[model samples]
Target: MNRKRTALSAAAAGTTAGVVGLVLIAAPAGADTTPPALPETTAESLVASVLTTDVPALSGTVAVSSDLGLPIPGLPTGDEAARIYTDGEGKARVSLIEGDGEKTLVADGATTWLWSSADKSVVKYTGGARDKAGEEQRLTDPAAAAREFVTAMGDESTLSVDGTARVADRPVYQLVVTPKPSERTLLREVRISVDSETRVPLRLEVLANGSAAPALSLGFTEFTPGAQDASLFTFTPPAGAKVTDGNAEVGKHEPTEQQKQDLLNAIKPKVVGSGWDTVYVGTVPADLLESEVTTEDKGGREGGKTTGLDLVKQFGQPVSGAFGTGTVITTKVGTALVTDDGQVAVGAVPQQVLVDALGQK
Candidate 1:
């Protein structure tokens, strides 16, 4: 088998509307005003409106805060900011602030660029080659995540309006998604802040079971909705920056578009189960795992016998079950399991749900 790296890695990073966020300063201690009146719609109607609402082209700053205690390398933690811009044509840009460095993502029509200021490296992709409009579309980011749950409501999840509040100084409705009694998940609720006038999702908060705080939160700290410049969606490698095609294979040839589609169709994973307890399973090639571990070793102490799971457990708790011993890593928003038999399961449910998922084979 010819080993090849597809553009799957870039799919998650592609749909970002390149919007960087600005930090808001606190107002005077005595400043106060009555919050706007609550919206006059039931949760179901509000959710329906949100799903069908087409957010206008605009640029704004978004804040992402996560307490998911995963040791996943390169996972951004704490309260970080990003500037997101969208042109209403599915073209968007995201500039992420990472301390003194920044990582920018610009997604044009059929191409995307990932640039890192720290390393001065650029990775270009050939767009979302998989079923992006389906399973993968929901993971675009936190703001989009709220829209996803709203669209996915009505069946496995119960939708209700948790009333209204002012977020980012705008009056909005709080749409909440609560898992049904039969749904096995750790999430207590997923709250979406929808701009009352625009019906666009302004923020999302994911709260774990029995937790008072959000495990994962994403929303605009400030928003200025309007037409964005055309330049935000375009990118050119800066002078002296290294560039690499995302679909470049190991051999001397580049994979054609048809080849990329074929590769995606070949390895397309299947989703087993439903609702919050869903599991994604696919047969990833051995070289993919090998390359992943090798990359990790390049950063850690040389000659460590540990593979990906070993390194993952260093930051998570050790877990074992009949589904075969593997580490279970839990974030504030969800939990995941990496089985010894090369099967992986992730969701907001507890570790046992993953064990059950691994047994489905």
Candidate 2:
């Protein structure tokens, strides 16, 4: 649990490429066929405007599409769509639509409810847990995602206003972000569509090197900027559904100081290099290294069974270097190296970059 907390914090800070990919997944404006006409504006002004603009009460449908090209067994891919409602006053609701059921998360200023329709279960959060849930909810918001990139942009990047386009039927200004010549990354550029009137980002498109289309795209398919129903922010568990207090077990089984240190030493999360080439280095927990992830049969369909070692043998290629022998899993936007000794190095860079990162002391 401590490792999970540490890893999540690291990812939230943008220190790991894998988490960056996930955060980016949390929401893009896709390319529109016809370009819109917009008045002359500087990237500086646009950035400032997006940062300062107050988000008004709104509701929309968010569509996430990814083509990472890593078809790991049991991993969900392609399109994931959700509906979002916000009162623009710290109260919000997000419903993630799955195969046949829905998972809804609602935060009503002071409390948060996470309900799963498929399992008929709900988790209620209060106090600090409620606040944490609200923060995680914003990660899936396109405007928040856009602001993340804009704020994360550093001297290593070059930004400019490319053109104007219409996203979700609203005219928007397109801002393009590209890495400097010295940065080594598989990503080519990031494109964001900012609403012309609200200055809020409507869509984000991330294209990889050598690819014409965006490897990942997230945006609102339907957006309405106005006050949302107050009822949407409140939730009541259905009859017969099981409810659990999310904060009830906070100190029920606290780990000793030595145990915490031991777990931290075992994982040993480390970052090598900087910028887009940065790699996240860690060790595979012994339990996971020895175990496998097998899908369970659900809805009468036969579950596909596979092991961790099986995946490495099936999808990874053998690589050996100064860092030692391991298998490297390559995707359209990133690469992961898994050493035979249970070490791992992952980054949005070439395989050699991962190898060099692992070789670093």
Poorly placed runs, candidate 2 (over 4 Å):
1-32, 72-76, 131-136, 249-259, 285-287, 292-310
lDDT at residue 283 of model 1 (Cα atoms) = 43
TM-scores for every predicted model: 0.71, 0.82
Give the per-residue lDDT of model 1 (tens digit) for 1-361: 1232345445434534222111113453223346578648988788778788887887778887877765456554677788878887778887877779998888887877778999999877774531222222233355567765666655788888877777777788888888898988888888898999888898898898877988888887777778988988899999999987764522336577899887666555668778877766554444443443543353455564555655656656777877767777887667777665555677778877777777776
* Candidate 2 lDDT for residue 181: 76
Model 2, range 1-361, lDDT digits (tens) per residue?
9999998998777767777777677645443467877898998899899989988898988888888888654433688888998988888899998879998999888888999899999988898867555655665688888888777765668889999888888889999988887778898989998999989898998899988988888888888899888889888888999998877754455577999998889999999977777799999777777686665554656566776766675678898999778898998888989998889999888898888888777
- Which has the greatest lDDT? 2
Looking at candidate 2, what is the lDDT of residue 204? Answer: 93
TM-score of 1: 0.71
| Best model number under TM-score | 2
